[model samples]
Target chain A: MSTLTSHRTRPPAQPETLRARRLPAYAAPAIAVAALALAAAIVYGAGIGGPVLVIVLGALLYLVGLFAAANAVEGRRAARNRTWSALIHSAFVLAVLPLVSVVWTLVSKGAQRLDADFFLTSMNNIGARDPNGGAYHAIIGTLEQVGIAVLITVPLGLLCAIYIVEYGRGKFAFAIRFFVDVMTGIPSIVSGLFVLAFWVLIVSPWFNDGRPSFSGFAAALALAVLMLPTIVRSTEEMLRLVPAPLREGAYALGVPKWKTILRVVLPTALPGIVTGVMLSIARAAGETAPVLLIAGGGAAINFNPFENNQSSLSLYVYQQAGSASKYAPDRAWTAALTLVALVLILTIAAKLLARRNRLSR
Target chain B: MGETPHRSADAGTGGTRVTQSHEWPAGASARVAEAPVSTRSPDGSGLGGGGALPRARAFGAERAFHGLTLAAGTTVLVIIVAIAIFLIAKAIPALRANTASFWTFEGWFPNDNPPTFGIGALAFGTVLTAVLALVMAVPVAMGIALYLSHYAPRRLGNALGFLIDLLAAVPSVVFGLWGRDYLIGPVTDFSGWLNKYFGWIPIFGGDGPYGNSILLGSLVLAIMVLPIITSLTREVFLQTPTANEEAALALGATRWEMLRTAVLPYGRPGIIAAVMLGLGRALGETIALALTLGATYSISFNLLESGGNTIAANIANRFAEANDTGRGALIASGLVLFAITLIVNIIARAIIYRRREFTESAA
Candidate 1:
């Protein structure tokens, strides 16, 4: 209300005049005292064990001090604003705290053994007694499995999205949308069970019997199933956004519709397509259930998708963490952190690529 | 037609001006007639000409490409359908062979001489935990979405949204570990208080050690799903038509009233979609449930003390250890979960479709 009054009284060019008229420039010390008290409470909480009652009291006092400070500085309205802002900041902090704690725990514990050997050697010959085992085979399996999944899903998903957005008219589009919606919500374990039951029991019962069973191809197929829906939805939106004017211009030059969609539309929408694909990749990279069910944990480093047992980072984390050995479990924490780091790296890479493309073009 | 005069007072100079001799409105029709007909058609000989050959060839190629794209897309659909059919077929013999009821039985001791399995406990636990999560999550999630969309400063909101998105993308296993190491310890005390105060209610009537219980599992799930609902609701609310909000404000409505009247109604379908999306994540969640729910199979309604198990968690826990029959039983349970999610998504799509129709008709 005071702001409105001052705005009406003051000229437009002199905005500072309104601030000077409405707000008294005082009460800075109250804010400082509140901050000091908050700092003291944090330090005391860090140093000493307190009764829940005392802690609650401290928190209440801290909030009251903040309210009083804001009220002194600006008035009841500013105090309310400060309170709401504090609540929002608290909510944001609450949302982030668990994640921060998890990452902190992983990095601190994982940093102990993330040496050169951790990435180079394999745990194939290492026993439960050994403390220096590594996960090279698992790392390799993760990459190959994810790469194969990407290879299978990208073109299929992209083409399907193109069909839906560009060529789809009515009934066929509705059917496709329904199926995609159904597929999106299917459980991860269902995909796993689907692959396992189909491949192991029904399709080729004898395929993995004589041979050591782990195969990257099986894992890749499962992840591909999980990734397809996300890819299609995202890519379809990107393709749909490619302006009709570009296609019409191409048509005016006697270019084929397919050629126009391919040459002009896709090029315009390439960055979004890449972003969608990368998001799928990021999602697929961390999946543990389907990979576990399909890709039987292999010990040795086998990069070939068709070959015997290969392990992924997720499976490796599960394997080690679930094992009886203390050292392997510790290493599992490290491996888990390494996997998180790898996924984060890929995400950052995708963002950078998208950014570069956007800027350059 | 190409021989028509190209010059007009307006076109030649690229300006709209009236001459002393020509009144503007009167000359409009004259200018339209004086425009060259050749400029109207970009194609040579505009229509019904031998030049149509190139156009026909382009159309043919396009048609073939369309066919190819359709075939390619159908291949993906075929793969998905084939996988589902193959699994159902493989599991059918086991499902049919069992003489006992598969869903009513509370036990899931598949490793015994004779497998006795049912989805009673799993289904109960799944629904209970997911409901618990939804109850805890929806208000805070919507609040955050509203704050970020309407209240927070733009830069702050964007930064917060990015941070939340990153948090949402954190792996489930990490959340599981975090829940076990951090949340469980703190939440146990809170759960104990709930039991103490609300024990009259059957849901909270349990013993003190609620550390690895359904309530804790739900809490973990709630935290994990918060970002998803928040981001989605933010988008939905952001897409609310601006004119409606302005109209409400113009009619002497408060900010809250404007949001209640204009923004939320416009975003109803989106909110449903967002909720379903969160529910989908909650339904399929495994690792977090595994860590917090303690993998106990019980049919109790009590949430605070007893350990519970969701279908996804049960399958993950038992799949590798189960023999053929046991695996089949778990797969059957998975089939039930699949049907539930499929139904949910279908309903969500229907709501979105109805929203589209409603908006179009209203317009």
Candidate 2:
């Protein structure tokens, strides 16, 4: 046994232990800075382009330089890995650019008109030349339309989700789930067109002296269609997250199935449901095509959604953007900022609620 | 009949019966012990007597609630069917009135005396722009997704991912306004550069006019879709089993190689689904494309030229002034758009469903 052990050679001296030599922590940032400087010099010296061009050229140069340097220092596989890592990180940076630009532009352009008058008054008497028009009327129209849409969709969407999570079985349930997914992908404009064809052209003519009229109610209907799938899908996810043991526990105590769902399941999923509803509401409030098609953007403060023309903030932005008035641009920007603010607030709130739910659970 | 004596014994000595049952012969005695309680209280009421318990009222509220939820579920199906039916109904009259072939003709003159219109150019532009957007978006989105899923620190990844989702919530009209007002200048400059450098390429070949071209529209679309693809693909990549990933790494694979062997293969279906969903979104985008495209009716491949039109954009552009037949024509175009998006979405869903089954079975 000792002779056999001695005869087994010592594994060829271990071959440098497969050393994985990593680049220093400062390597990437140093390389990026040098690349940018080189790109800027070349671009400026050649009189080729501006800051945007320099940035693009710099990013390209950085990627190439990173690959080459890594390939030279490390072997090909490690270089390839580093190159991909750099590409991925840069890709993220690239995406952040547009978001930053968009938010910056919105704020800088929108703040010029963010006054109390912009929120309190309507655009009714403000002429094209006047820069005094506000989105108050549009804001009101948006609230009423979104409110009515929420009223119609929430109960229906909740019940559908409950049905799917609690009692769903076989092909019918599958079909419902599938169609709900399909409906979620329906374009906002098509929903508007559906409302226009069914309600405005066919049904509303009966009420409005043989003439079709646009109303906020039509917009609400369209928004409801848009909101339904989102709410249903979200609520379904939240409901499914409810544990089976909770339901069984209630059942063991002589509680009926419906009561178990109502008392145990729904209350547990309530925060998530609210999050979904808020998200859907945010989406509905930002929709322009449907509102433009059905609400018939009007300047006046129309309180009754069922009656005449009403303009939403989204429609107001679109109209103001398209209008020939020079002052209209400011109003459009301001209205857009308002719309975005409203949407972002709702989205952030929903996300916060969702996060809280995850922690508590 | 053989179990009756055992059942009576079980009932007489409830606590002791449980202990004795374990000691008894394997199957028959245990069955006999359990049978009387199960048979007597089918609903598991736990009542001791053999006498029947009084039944409650026929669960009227439960039945009512079930019916209400079922009706709500049914309503979604009804709404989908109604949309298609109503669209077809509205489109038929305009189609009948068309002097031109709806499939082949390029120009839209639906308001003319004979009312000639077609979806040829609109459909072409729609497909072209959406394809271009996906081509530009998918790679970068995959990269971003990989960064979030595999590269960034967990907390940072989560925060950045949340920010990206908020980007999705930004309204299309806001994108439209920004694209038209702010992005047009930079896009025009880039188009000129492309024309100067890559004029031999058919897509980049165009004359002086460049702003509001298909290139601009597609760029906006790419940005708009970037967040969606990134978020979805990140989710999919994160779902790649750590075991598979670690196995590749343990086999002396580089980070990229490990991802290629494990994460990429696992996420192929998900990536395809995400791309198709993005395509559907780009196809049906109305206001953004409406504002970005030059609103010309041509099926040219010169993306840098200021000439492109999509069905959704055409409908949004012409709907306000459309007469009876023109409205029908626009509705017909919208129906066409709807059909295209429906096909894309269904294909995406199919891929997702199949992948789900595969994963579930594997798991």
The candidate that wins on TM-score is 2
Each prediction's DockQ against the real complex: 0.22, 0.43
Candidate achieving the largest DockQ: 2
Candidate 2 per-residue C-alpha lDDT over B125-149 given as tens digits, one digit per residue, 9 for 90 to 100: 9999999999999999999999998
RMSD of 2: 7.6
Tens digit of per-residue lDDT, candidate 1, span B312-343: 88987787787777777777887788777777
lDDT of 1 by residue, A65-114 (tens): 76776677556756665565555545555556665776788788778888
Off by over 4 Å in 2: A1-55, A358-361, B1-59
Error of 2 at A174 (Å): 0.9
Question: In candidate 1, which residue pairs clash?
Answer: A214-A309
The C-alpha stretches of model 1 lying farther than 4 A from their native spots are: A1-90, A206-214, A352-361, B1-51, B54-63, B97-99, B196-200, B240-258, B360-363
lDDT of 1 at B212: 87
Estimate, for each residue in A64-123, the C-alpha lDDT of model 2 and write its tens digit.
988888888787898899888878888888888887888899999999999999999999
Q: What lDDT score goes with residue A230 in model 1?
A: 85
